[model samples]
Target chain A: MSHQSKRIILKSFPQGHPKESDFEINTIEIKEDEVKDGQVLVKLLYVSVDPYLRYRMKQVDNKAFQGYKLNEPLTSICLARVISSKHGSLKEGDNVTSWNLTWQEFSIVKGEELNKLPSNDLPLSYYLHSLGMTGFTAYFGLLSVGEPKEGETVLVSAAAGAVGMLVGQIAKLKGCKALGIAGGKEKVEFVKSLGFDDCLDYKTVDNMDEAIKKFCPNGIDVYFDNVGSETLDAVLLNINDGARLPLCGSISNYNDTKEAQGPRRTFNLISKNAKMEGFLVSKYGKDFGKAQQEITEWLKQGKIKEQIDERNGMEKIVPSFIDLFHGRNTGKVVVKIADE
Target chain B: MSHQSKRIILKSFPQGHPKESDFEINTIEIKEDEVKDGQVLVKLLYVSVDPYLRYRMKQVDNKAFQGYKLNEPLTSICLARVISSKHGSLKEGDNVTSWNLTWQEFSIVKGEELNKLPSNDLPLSYYLHSLGMTGFTAYFGLLSVGEPKEGETVLVSAAAGAVGMLVGQIAKLKGCKALGIAGGKEKVEFVKSLGFDDCLDYKTVDNMDEAIKKFCPNGIDVYFDNVGSETLDAVLLNINDGARLPLCGSISNYNDTKEAQGPRRTFNLISKNAKMEGFLVSKYGKDFGKAQQEITEWLKQGKIKEQIDERNGMEKIVPSFIDLFHGRNTGKVVVKIADE
Candidate 1:
C-alpha cells in the first residue's frame, strides 16, 4: 500500500526576512513496503518552529550550521509515534522524539537515533521544548557561561521567548535579581507573571541604556543576550565592572542584509574589565543528560515554568514560523500536525 | 638652600592629539628644608613615558585611571637615587623605583612607599620597563586571561611596544606560535628579531584581514590586542572557535574626539564561541611579586629581550611622551633626566 504525505519544502533562499513564498507545500506518495530494514516510519504529531530556523533559511555555507537546501524538506525537532517498525528496538505505537525529522506528516528515521520518551503525566509537546534543546541551551548559557551569582543583577533580552524565559527563571532561582527586556507591554506582563523581578518594554522605551540603568541601578552583572543589536549595545553601556555577557543568539541581526554599524563598545569592556563570550548549546553535548535531568527535576518541582504558543494543523506552520521573527509569539512556537 | 626643579605640567587638556602647548614647563623652587618627616628627596634618573598617559590626558573622569591635574607635575614610574632621607628606611645614594615620581629632576616621595631595587647587573632603566609594570601587564594579560595553549597561534598588536614585546617573547616561551602586528617595516623587523614567527606591518597592509588569514592559516587562538580600531575589526572576522582575546589597551581611540564607529562584530564572537576580556595590570597587585620573579628569571636567562628608546634630558620628556602617540618610538619610551 502507498500513502500520500504532505510536506513543506524550501522553495527559495531568503535575502532578508522569510516569506510564505519561500516555502511550498508538496504531496508525495511513499510505499510502506519500501521502508529500509533499520528504519521506522514515524507519524509526526508536533513540529517545533524556532527563531534559529531563520538563519538556516539564508543560503550560506556555515560549517557550524548548514542552511537548508532548496527543493528539500526542512527538518527540525519533532514529536512522533511509530506507525510501522522494521528495527529490533522500535515497534508500532511507540512514542519518540528525534531531531532528524522532516516537515512531512510522515518520516522514515533510523530506530537507533530515536529517543524513546518516558510515559509521564506532562504533555508530550514539552519534550519538543522545555525538556529539549531550548532547555539545554538555557541551562548551559546561563549557568556555565553567564555564571550568575547570588544578589547579582541578571538581564535577559527577548524575555518572552523560550530560552530567555528559562534564563530569567533560572537566574531568579539562583537568587539573582532577574530583569527581562521584551518587545511589547503584553510580553512584559507575561514575563513578569513568569516571576521575573521586573520587565522592560523595549518597544516603548525612548532610550534603552537609560532604561536599563534605571532598572538595574547596580549595573548588569550578567547579561544573557539573545537579541544582539541595539539591546546589546544598551546593556554594554550600563554594565558593572567584571560583567559577564553570554552571547547566545543575535536574532536582531539575522535578517540584516548589510553589516551592522554601532558605537564601538570594546573600550567599555576594557575599562570595566568585563568579559563577553559567545556559545552554542551543541558545545555541551557530552553533558546534555545531566542538564536534562536537572531541568526535568526543576520542572517537576515547579521551580521552572514552560509556555507554548501552539497553532493547529500543519498548514499553519509557515505563518506560525513567520510570526516568530515578528515577535508575535509569547513563548515556544509549535505547530500541531496531528493528535497523538 | 632651595633647588629649582623644572617640571612638566598640563597647561590644558587636548581635544584630540596632544600638542606641546598643552604642556608647560614650570621651574618651581623647592625649599629642601620643607621636606616632610615621612618624605625623602630623590633625584629622578629615568622617568617612564607610557601610552596610558594619553588616556590620563583626557578631561573625562575614569574610575579605573585618573587624569593628571592641571598646573601640577605629571607623575609616572621613575628610577631615582635617594639624595636625602627624612624617615627610617631610605638613605642617601640608595637607588629606588617609585610610581610617585614626577617628570622633574627631583621629587619628594614617602620613604616607605619606595621599592628598593636589589643591586643587579641589569641596567637601572630596566627597573622602569621590563621588571616593572610593563612586564607584569604582559604576564597577567597573556598567561592569566589569554591562557594560550602550546601550538596555538598567538597574535600581539603594537608588537614593538614595551608590553607587546614581552607578550610575544612569553608566548613563544610557552610553546605557542607568536605573530606580531606592528606599524612600520622597522617595527616589523624589530619584533621579528625578538623570535616572533612573523610580523605584519599594519600600515603597509591594505587588507589586514587577508594578511592575518595568510599568516595565521588555522586562525588566531589568542589575540593580545593593544591598538584597538580597524585592526581589531579585521581580526574579528578570522578568529577560530573558542578564541581568547585579552583586551589590554586601545591606544587607537585614546585621541578620538568622538565615539568610534565600526562594524558591530559581536555577532562574529557569537558564531565562533569566542571570549574577549579586558583587564588592568593593577588588578594583579597581590600576585605582582610572583610575576616579577618569573619575568626577572626569564630576563636573566636571555629568554626575554628588552628594548629602550632613551631620550636625553628632562626637557625632552614632553616630546618623548608625545612621540608615543605618533608611533615614532620602537620600544619603551623613557627620558634620561640624570645619571647616578
Candidate 2:
C-alpha cells in the first residue's frame, strides 16, 4: 500500500504580490501503515485557495494564527476521501472535508479532525463553494454579523468572488436591495445577473464616492466588506445610521508587502452610530449544519446559484492560487487534484 | 420677568485647533412670556466642554450629529435650575440637566427634554461627570461594547480624560487587569492614583508599540479607544484574540483639518477575531438609571474617584473648551456659570 503524493509547500515569503515561484511541489512516499490508531488515510479530491492564505504566509506573532512554516506543505479547507481508517467513526470511501487537509494527493490525518460530508447528489465541488466554509461565511457574515434587513440596501465588495456573490443573493432573498462594488465590467455584469440590484465597476469609476452614491442612493445599511482600503473608507462616508459592516478579509491589502497605512473614515462610525465586526468562518462550526440545510434548500429550489472557477490538474495549483490576487477568476477558486 | 442671558456662539470654524476667536459671547434679552405651555426657563448652572464638540464644529452630513451652524449658539449637555416653568412636569427651583441646553446663563427649553435631578445633595456639578453622561458613557461603552471579562486585560486610551478614566476604573471593578494610555506624565500619575494597574505615557514614550507591550504583557482584551490615530494603530497590534473595542470618540484626529488618511491597523481585527463598535452615549439613555445607581454606589463608597478640571467663569468658555485639544485638562472639563 505504498503511494507517492506530490504536495505544494511555501518556498519563500512573497515580497509584494504572491507569485507562482513562491510555492514548490515535493513528492513523498508513504504507506497505509502510517495511519496509526485513531487516524485515517485521506486521498485529496479538491484543494481550495482563499485570500486568507496570504495572511498565513506572513510571519505574524498572533496566537490565533501561527504563520505557516517554510518548506512545509500548506493546509486549507480541502475536500478529500478517506482511503483507509483505523479510527472509531470513519470508514474507507467516505467523503470528508477538513480545514486541516494538506495540499497533496493523500495524507494521514487525525480521525476527529475530518468531518464526513453528507450524501448529496449536488456536485462534490459545490461543498467547496455553496455548502462549505465559503457559503457558511456568506451566511453567518451576512445574517449574523451584517444583519441585512428587509427593504434596506446591502452593499458587498469583491461582489463576484466566492463569498461575495452568495452574500449579495442572500441579502436579496431577505428582501433587501443588493448593491455590489466589483473591479471589472464582466464581474459587475455577473454580480448584477445574480439578482444584485446594482453593481459598481470600481476600475472604471473616476469617483468612488459618486459611483457608490449613484447605485446606493439611499446609503448603505449593511456593507459586507471583502476588500478593505479606500473602498471601505468611501463606503464609511455613505453608511446609514446603525450601519453594520461584516468584514471577512481585505483581499486588496493581502498582496501588499507593507501595511497600507491609509486613513480610515472611522469618524463616520461615531457620527452615524455604525459598527464593524470582523469574523472568521471557523467560529461558526457549531451552527454549520443549520446554515448548510438552508443553503441546500436554496440550491435545490434554484433560488441561489454559486459560480465555480475550476482549475484542472495538481500541477497548476501554484498558478491557480496566484490568479486570485490578480483578479483573473471569479467565484470559488478550486483546483482539482483527482476525480471524485 | 425679563433677563439678559450671556451665550456662546460659533464665531468661525477653526482650521486645526479651535481658538478663543472662534467663539463669541452674545447677550440676549428674553421675557418669561416667551416660555410656551410645555417649556421651562432654565438658568445655567454648569456647561460641559467635551472632545466630541470638536467634531460638531465641522461640516458632517451625518443625521445623528449635525454640525454647528455659523453665527449660532453652540449647545451641549448642561446642568441647570428651572427659574420658571410653564410645564406640567417641572416647577420653579427644580434642578435639572438637558443635552438640549444651550451654552448660556439662561434659556427656555421644552420640559420633556429635561431630566430633573433627584436632589441627592451630591455636588450638582457631579451630574456633569460622575453621576451623569460621562459615567454612563464609561459604563455602557466598557460593559456593553468592551465587554471586559474577569482577569482579562482592559486597556483604555486617553485614560486621563472624562470617559477614559471611568472606563479603566470600571474595568478594574469588573475583576480585570486595567491598563491606561494617557498623554503626559502627570495625567498618567493621576490615572494610576485612580487605581489602574498600569498606564502608558504616549507623549514621552519613544515607541508606542513597545510602551503598550510593556504595560500589556498578556495582550489587550478590551480597548476603550478615545484617541483614534496612531495610538489606535499601535493598540491594534497588541490585542488578544476576540478583543472588543468600544470607540466613543477619536479626539486625536478631530483637530486635523484634513482627513488623517493614515493606515488603520484594522487587519488586526480579522487576525485576532476582534471587533470595533463606535457608539454614542445618547443611545443608552433608556438604561441610564441602572448605570447611574451603580455609579452612585461606587462614588459613595469611594471605590471610584472622578477628577474634575473646573473652569470658573462663563467669559472663559472659549479658552476652557480650547484647553481640551491642547491636552491641558486631566479630567472632565466643566465650565461653571452659576452656583446652586
Candidate 3:
C-alpha cells in the first residue's frame, strides 16, 4: 500500500523571530514494502510545539546543538501510533513514541527506539506532555537540580508554561512556597489556579526586582527559570542565601538576533552563595520510567493538574509554534495530526 | 605598664579606588590592667591586606558585611604574639591568630577566640597565606565547587594574586591541565613558573574569548573566577559541556559606583549544561582541618608553590591593599607589623 504524506522542511533559517516563510511543506510517498525488519511504521498522532525549536532554527557552529539543516525535514520527540511493525515485540495498531519523529503523517522509526505507551486512563495526547518530556523536564529540573527544601520559596518564570505550571505545583507539594512570574491577567489567573502561592503579572510591573521581592516575601530559595534575560536578572537580585537556579530554558533570548545586554546582577548570586545550573531532559533518560510512573500516579489522584491547548490538522503546527513566542497560547501547545 | 599603640581608623569612605587620605592613624593607650581575666594583651605580627577589606569600607544597609564606621579602628583576622595574659590557657610569648584583631601595635583579645599556631619550619607569615583564609579560599573554591576531574582543563583569572596562584598549582597537583589569565607580563610569567600549563597576559590581548580558546584547546571544564565582567563573559562563550564555574570574587566590579552592564553570554551555559556556584570558606569550617592537612603536606612535598609580597610596618597596610586593585603587587600581599 502507498501512503501520501506531507512534512515541513526548513526553507530558510530565521532572522530574528521565526516567520512561516522559513518553512515549506513537501509531499512524500511511503510504501508498506519499505518497513524493514526492526522498523515500525508510525503515524504521528500529535506534534508538540515548543520554544526549543527556535534554537534548532539557528545557524550555530557548536556541536552541543546541531541546528536544523536547510531543505531537511523538521523533527521532534512527539507522540505517534504504530501502524505496522516488522519487529516481533510490537504488532499493528500498537501505540509508541520515540525521538526524531518527523513533522509528517507517517514516519519509519527503529522499533528499538520506540517506547510502547502503557494502558492508562489519561489522555493519549498526554503521552506528549505530562507523561513524557514536558513532565520529566519539570520533575528533574525541580527535584534534582533546584533541590527545593521544605519552608523555602521556589519561584518560576513563565509560570503558565508547560513546564513552569507543573514546577510551581510540585514545589507546593514539596512543602515550599510557590511563586510565579507570568504575563498579563489571564496567565496569572491560570498560574494561581495551579496552586501557586502567588503569581506576578510581569507585563503590569515596573521594577521586576521589587515586584518579585513583594511576592517572594521570604526570598527565593530555588528559581526554576524558563524565560531568561531580564527575568533571570531580577531573580538573581531577589534570591536568598544558598539559592539554587535550575536553568530549564532561555525562551526570551532564543528569538534575539544580536547579543543581549543586561544589568550584571549575577554577581549578587556570588555574594549570596547561590548557584545556577542548565540542564536538558534527554540526559536523564535512565530515570525517565520512574519519573513518568510518579507523574502518572499524580494525574490519577488528581493531585496534579495539566492543561493542553490543542489545535487540529498538520498545517496548524508551525502557526501554533509561532503562537508560543508571541505568548498567544497557554499550557502545552500541541497540534493533533489525526484521530486514532 | 602603659603602652602607646597606633591603629589605623576609617577617616572617610572611598569614592573609587581607596586612597591613603581615606584612613588616619590614631594613638591610644593600652594598660596591662585592661587585659582582664580571659583576655590577653597581644602584639600584632603580620596583618593580611586583602581586597575583601575594601567591602568593609563601604557604607551599606545589609548585614552580610558591616562597613567600618568613621573614626573607628580597622580590624582583621591577623597574626599576633601574647605580651600579657589573664587567661588560663595562654601565657606570655604564645603565638596566636584571631578574628577582629585591631590593626594596632597592641590589642587585648579573648583567649577563647584565638587559634594557637602549631610549630612548623615554614615562615610565620604562611599562616596569613597558604595556611589561612587565602589558601582555604583556593582549596574549597577549586576542589569542592569547581570539582575538576583529572585530565580536565582548569582555568583561573587573576592568576598571580594570593588565591589565584594557589588555585592553579592545586589544579595541577590534582592531575589537571592548568591555565591562567593575568594582567601583565610579569604576573603571567609568575603564574607559568608556578606550574600553569599556559598563561594569557589579558592586558596584551585584543579579544579574550579568542585568546582563551587558543590556550584551552580541549575547552575549559572548570573556571575559578576571581576577575568577573569581560573575562567572565569571555569564558562563558568558550565553555564546554558540563563546565563548573566557582565564583570566588568579582574584583572587576567592586569599585563600580553604578549598576554594571555586560554581554549576557551566561545563556550559553544553558545549552552547554554548565553550572556556576559561589562559596565562602567560613561555611566549610568543619572540613578545614582535613583540607589544611592536605595543603600542608602538598607544600612540604614540593608539590605546590606559594609567593608572598611582604610590606614592612603597619603604615604599609593601607597602601598595599590599594596596590591590589592597581595590579601593583604580584603575590599574597601582607604587611609585617612587628618582629617575632
Candidate 4:
C-alpha cells in the first residue's frame, strides 16, 4: 500500500527566539513494503508542545538538548496508534507514546522507543500529561529528588502549567502542604482547585517574598521550580533548613535573548543546609517503567486528576508551542491531530 | 592545687563589624576546688581564630548561629591541657582539644567535650589543624562529600589557608589532579609545593575563567570551596558533569557590607548535571570519630601537612581576626594566649 503523510520540518535554525518561518509543512510518500524491521508505522494522534523543544531549535553546543538540524523533522512527544507493525510486541491497533515522535500525521517509530499504552482505561491525552513524560517528571522531581516530607510546605512555580500542576498535587497527596505560583488569578484559582493548600498570582504579587511569607507561614521546604527568574529569587529567601529544590525547568529564561537576572540562591543554600538538584526525566530511564505503572495506577484510582487544553489541527503545532511561552494554555497543552 | 585562673568575657555586642571596643576581656578568678564532678579545669594554650566568628557577631533570629550576646565570652576551638579531672578518664598534664572550649587562658570544660590527644605521637597544634575541626572539615568535605575520584580534577579555592591547603593535599592523595586558587604568588607557590597539580593566584589573573581553564584543562570533578564569590562563579562554568562541590565556607561574601553579586552556578548545575552540597562538620557528629581516627592515621604516616600562623597574646585576637578579612594570614591563624 502506498500512502502520503503531512509533517512539519525544521526550515531553518532559530536565531534567538523561534519564528514561524523556521518550520515548513511538507508532504512525504511511503510504501508499506519499504517498512524496516523492528519498526511500527504509527498514525499520530496527540503531540506534546514543550518548552525544551524551543531550545532544541537553537544552534547551541549543549550536550543536554542537542539542537535540531535545519530541514529535519521537528521532534516532540507523540501519542500515536500503530497502523502497521514489524515489531514483536506491538500489533496493528496498539496505541503508543514516543519521545522522539515528530509533529507529523504519521511516523515510523522504532519498537523499543514506543511505549504501549492501555487502550480503553484512560483518556488518550492523559498519556501526554499525567501518565506520560509530564506526570513522570512531576512524580520523580517531587517524590524522589525533591523528597517532600509530610507536613512540609512545598512551593511550585508555573503551578497551573503541565508539570507544575501535577507536582503540587503529588506533593499534596504525600501529606505536604502545597502552594503554587502562576501568572494570573485564573491559573491560581485553577491550581487551588487542584487541591493545593495555597496559590499565588505572580502577576499581582509586587513583593513575592512578602506574599510567600504570608502563605507559607513556616517556610518553604520543597521548591519544585519551573519558572526560574523572580519566583526563584523570592523562594530563595524563604527556604528553610534542609530544603530540597528540584529544578525541572526554567521556562522564564528559556526565550530570553540576553542573560536574565537568574535567582542567586547559592548563599541561601549554605545558611539553610539546603540541597538543590537540576535534572531531566531522561536521566531516570532505569525507573521510567515503574514510574509509568505507578502513575497509571494513580490516574485509574482518581488519586490525581488532569486537564488538557486541546488545540485542533496539526497546522496549529507552532502556534500551540508559541502559546506555551505566553502562558496561554492550562494543564497539559496537546494538539489533537485526528478524531478517535 | 588551690589556684585562681584568669578568663575572658564579652562585655558587649558589636554594632556593625566587631571591634576591640566590643570586648572587655576581664581576668576572672576561678577557684579549682569549685569544679564539679564530670568537669575538668583546663589551661588553654591555643585559641582558634575562625572567620565564622564574625558571622556570629551579627544579631540574627537564625537558630543555627545566634550571634554572641552582650557580656558573654566567645566560644571556639582551643588546645588545652587538663590541670584537674574529677570524672576519671582525664588526668593532670594530659593535652587535649575541645569543640566547647572558651576563648580564654583557662576553661572549665565538661569531661565529655574534651578529646585527649596522643602527646607521644603528634604536635598538640596538629590536633588543632589536622585532628581537630579544621582537619575534620577538610577530611569530611573532600572525601565524604566531594567523592574525589582517581584521575579526576579537584579544584580548591583559598588553597594556602587552613582547610583549603589540607583539602588539596587529600585530593592529591586520592590520585586526583589538584588545582588551587590563592590570593598571592607566594601562597600560590606554597600550595603548588604541597603537591597540587596547579595553583592560580586570583590577584594576578585578569580573567578568572581563563585562569581556571588554564589550570583545570580536563574540568573540575570536586571543588572544595572556601572562597565563594567570583572565584566560585568561574568554577561553576568549568565544572564537569556530576561534579561535587562541598560548600565549606564562603569567606569572600562573609563580610560584604554591600549587596555583592552572588555566585552564578545554578544554570551550570542544570547544564552539567552537577551537585553542590552545602554542609557543616557539626552535622556529621555520628561519623566524627571514624573521620578523626582516619585523619590521625594519615597524620602519623606523613600523608598530610599543616601550617599554623600563631599570633602571641590574647589582645591580638581582634586584630588577627580583622586581618583574616584582608587576606593577611598564610595558614591557620591561632592566638597564643600567655598565662602569667
* Candidate 4 lDDT (Cα, 0 to 1): 0.82
How would you encode candidate 2's per-residue C-alpha lDDT over B46-159 as one tens digit per residue?
Answer: 988888888788865545765799899999989999999999989999999987688888899899999999877578888999788888999998998888889999999889
Candidate 1, overall lDDT?
0.87
Model 4: lDDT of residue B78: 82
Interface RMSD of each: 1.7, 1.8, 1.8, 1.9
True contact recovery of candidate 1: 0.71
Model 3, A150-233: lDDT tens digits are: 999999988898999999999998999999989999999999898998899999999877887777777789999998888888
**Off by more than 4 A, model 2:** A32-35, B32-37
lDDT of 3 by residue, B1-340 (tens): 9889989998998877899999998799999888889999999999998887787887775455556899899988799999999899888998898856889999888999988888788888988999888999999999999999999999999999999999999999899999999988889999999999989999999988898878777888999999788888888888888999999887877777877774378777677889888776776889877887888898899988879899999789889889999899898988998999
Ten-residue region with minimum lDDT total, candidate 1 chain B: B259-268
Error of 4 at A102 (Å): 2.2
Q: Write the per-residue lDDT of candidate 2 for residues A96-187, one digit (tens) a residue.
A: 99976889888998999998999977999999998998999999999998988899999999999999999999999999999888889899
Provide the overall lDDT of each model, using Cα atoms, as 2-decimal numbers: 0.87, 0.87, 0.87, 0.82
Q: Could you estimate the TM-score for every candidate?
A: 0.97, 0.95, 0.97, 0.90
Clashes (N, CA, C under 3 Å) per candidate: 0, 5, 0, 1
lDDT tens readout by residue for model 1, A1-340: 6768999999998778888998999999867887899999989899998888787887776666667999999988888999999999889999998875899988777899898887777888888778888888888999999999999999999999989999999999999999999988899999999999999988888987788889788899999999887788888888898999999988887888887774367778877889999887888889988987888888899999889888998789999888888998998888899987
Candidate 1 versus truth, CA RMSD in Å, comes to 1.7
After superposing candidate 1 on the true structure, give the runs of residues whose Cα lies further than 4 Å from its correct spot: none
- Sorted into a CAPRI-style docking class, model 3 comes out as medium
Error of 1 at B146 (Å): 0.7
Positional deviation of residue A200's Cα in model 1 after best superposition, in angstroms: 1.3
Please say which candidate is ahead in TM-score: 1 or 4. Answer: 1
**Residue pairs clashing, model 4:** B10-B71
**Which 10 successive residues of model 2 chain A have the least lDDT summed?**
A58-67
